[model samples]
Target chain A: MDALLIDPVLARACGSALAVILLLGAWQKLRDMAVFEAAVELYRLLPDRMVPLFARALPMLEAAAGAALLLESTRGIGLVLALVVLGISTGGVLINLLRGHTDIDCGCGGADGNTRLSWALPVRNAVLMLLAVAGAQAGLARPLVWVDFITVAGGTLALLGIYAAGNQLLANHPRLMQLRNGS
Target chain B: MNEALMISNALLWVAVLAALIGLFALARQIGVLYERVAPMGALMIDTGPKVGEPAPSFELPTLTGNARVRIGGAADKSTLLFFLSPTCPVCKKLLPILRSVNETERSWLRVVLASDGEQPEHLAFYEKADLKPFPYLLSQDLGIGFHVGKLPYAVLMDEQGRITAKGLVNSREQLESLFTAKELGVASVQDFIDHQHDHQRA
Candidate 1:
């Protein structure tokens, strides 16, 4: 039963779902830059050097992802990016949950003024992963969607740029010693 | 002792929970973890909670302050008892939001904050959050059945005062059902949702 609930299959499923959420999230974040912007502000919770880079690039990275997911050509590329995003985001949630930081909201909501923290957030991502897997399996036969390709690619780049800056900021901040382990 | 040694604050403890879950998650992938622990987990999870049976109750020690009580003792309104500690940053973050739940609903909740420290710390917490109006309790028992080993456990009771849900209450839709039932005298599940929708539209 425990195996049934928390099984390797579930973890894999979770990972896949994470992929969907992250890819989609990366795109939404690109357009709004709100949470990423807040996360950048949280850079002070990290270090000094990473802030400038994070604040400047995160929005663009998300925008790129939006492009990739929308474009049919880069669907595969976008899916890969989605998996990576979920891995990081899941790690963040687990880390916070364990460390007793439950108040923190999942950082996936887009730039719009939505303050949602529904159960759907996680489940939706999981479904997305299944779709990603389908998309991957059908990659060869799948038709093209240039808009998705452009959006996802764009979001990926935007996220990468922001993440780099964010990491650096955490590395520099002296007071945010807790972030030193880079959890 | 080892757990104590590693843990210093509520935030750190939550991080530990995540890390530990991650370990189990990773272990399941590797097969090393499951080969050893799956049997034990199955036994524990299966016999633990079920329907048509009265739910278990708990009296836990507050990990961050001075107060304690046993929740789910029969009452008029079904109680949605939750255990959280101030030292836990997660709990702290949730406090302000919970404080406001009463204005929307007619208060089917009796939030019992269980912590693991002295009165001063608890007092400090009350002052910090300005939660003087809420009921607080101390738990020396470490919130065993209330899910203190993991932090942030909640239990719900029906109007008949029977346990409807316990341990973790993350299912927003289901949890809301209990609240709706308590808020309105409506009995059925669909009725509550329909009424809620009407209320929303109205």
Candidate 2:
């Protein structure tokens, strides 16, 4: 466990990345509440009466977790909140996938809100959960330096870029398969 | 030595960040290219009025106005009958594209909106969609005549009432391909590709 501790700078970078992702997810959901509500209804996990309420509350929770993650004092609670949210979402995806309801939208909004349900989504969520866990670990305290700031900023941006590229690839996967089958 | 190492580390971080940004941009471009190339052309269902055949003519009433709209006949400009519905989201999305096409192709093309629905519902949709410029026709016979099974289908008819090309179009590029098919003298882009392959094989 001691050997698994992340460097403070790297941990900060991870937290910041997760925070930005959560905030963006919340913003996307809030931007189109109706669409998000429809997606939640499609999940079939919540009762019809609860769908709208859950849909409305999820983004608020995500925003709260994301804001909490930004502050060092509240990062622990934020990580827990993020993990719970990710777990529930992944569970919903897993249930739907198992049910063979792959036609519904994933609702992981970005440029690719229309991406269908697939195994890749759970894997993506797992990766995010790993980031949350890694971000939760405390690292050895070290004196701050200007170079450290550059590394942290650069690292976070790179992580975000990689995340975006991965999402684009995920979005393209089904279309590529369709093309391959000559459909 | 410590100072020099820090400088090199910072420089390496900057380079990595630049490389990641470049990678992301390349990925985005690839995504766009996939979208552009995926739908080779509007999906030709093969059940509709065949290309190069004369379309069944219809004198339908405009939904918004009292004027009668002629669907197929000898005309100066080509007619593009865009079959759409008030409830179909994809059809709604294509309205803006249809509007732009109407504007750009005004010289040689007359775009008409077609659907089968009740008067009050369609009239409300027409007003809300701001479709006053294009003649909106509510005719079930028109849809059946064309064998349109999908929402947001398009049929392009030349001045002589011949359907030059027609198919299920979901995007702007797919819609434009109907015009391209007309220009190429091919039934559809799929036919154009098959022709190319045959030529190469020969």
Candidate 3:
């Protein structure tokens, strides 16, 4: 563990990127609570009665976790919360995929709400989980420097760009398949 | 040596950032291309009267007044038969679009609203939606004649009373695609796409 410890700059960069992604997702859900609620209902993992409660609470939890991750003091709790949220979502998607119900909306906020469930979603969640874990790991005891700031900012922005690009690819996958099938 | 290493690291990080930005822009362009190339007109269900066939005629009474509405016949202008229901949320969402189409295309088109339900409910919806400009009618025979199995279906008829285009339309773009299909002399947008593909291959 000691040998594997990352620099504080790297950990901070990961945490910042995850924080931005979580905050943006939470904002999209909150923008249209009704649409999110409908998406949750379509998942059918939760009972009809619990759908509204879960829908309302999930975004609040996401926003809270994102805020906590921004501060070093609360990052541990934020990491745990993010893992739980991602676990629940990935599990829901996996269950539906196993049942061969791939036509349902992903409910994950994207360029549009029409993204369908597919294998890529679970893989995306796994990548995000890995980021959360890396971000949560304790850093080596080293003094901060001016150059570290530039590296951290650059790293975080790069991570966010990769994430956005991945999401666009995922969103386009179904459309690409449809086009290919000539439907 | 430490100063030299730090400078190199900073330069490499900047380079990586630039590359990531380029990748992101490339991905966004791919998304735009998909949107442009995807055939996104109103979905045409093949159960209804075929395009270019004479539309089944109907002379139903308007919901609000005693005026009789003639659906299919030789008219001075083209007719747009929009099938809707008061209970359909999408249909309600499209009322404003239909009104705008009525206003803009009034010169060459006549928009008529059709539905089959209780008169009182439709009358209430008709009043609430402020659809006084278009002629609203209720006729089960018209719906049965068209074999409409979906809400928010539409049929476009030319002045010769021939079915120019028909489909299940959900958005303003889909609604306009009916006119586009007619103008292009294609049976449907899917047909148009296939035609384009054939031309490219040839």
Compared with the true structure, all predictions reach lDDT values of 0.46, 0.80, 0.81
lDDT of 2 by residue, A1-183 (tens): 554356887787888898899999999998867668767866768887898899899888888888888888998999989998888889999999999877666877845575778999999999999888777766677797887788778878888888887887887776667666755
How does candidate 1 fare on TM-score?
A: 0.39
Decide which is better by TM-score, 2 or 3: 2
Q: How many Å off is the CA of B11 in candidate 3?
A: 2.9
Expressed as tens digits, the lDDT of each residue in B92-163 for candidate 3 is 558778988898778778999998868997898788668899899898778778877556899999998999
lDDT, model 2, position B139: 83
TM-score of 3: 0.61
Q: For candidate 1, what is the DockQ-based docking class?
A: incorrect
lDDT of 1 by residue, A124-178 (tens): 4564555445434322223445433433343434333333333233222221222
- Please give the C-alpha DockQ score of model 2: 0.20
> What lDDT, from 0 to 1, does candidate 1 have?
0.46
Tens-place lDDT per residue, model 2, B21-107, is 787778778766655554422223436578999999899888866799898879999999999876554576688889888887787
lDDT measured at residue B121 in model 2 versus the true structure, 0 to 100: 74
- Report the Cα lDDT for residue B134, model 3: 88
Arrange candidates, best lDDT first. Answer: 3, 2, 1
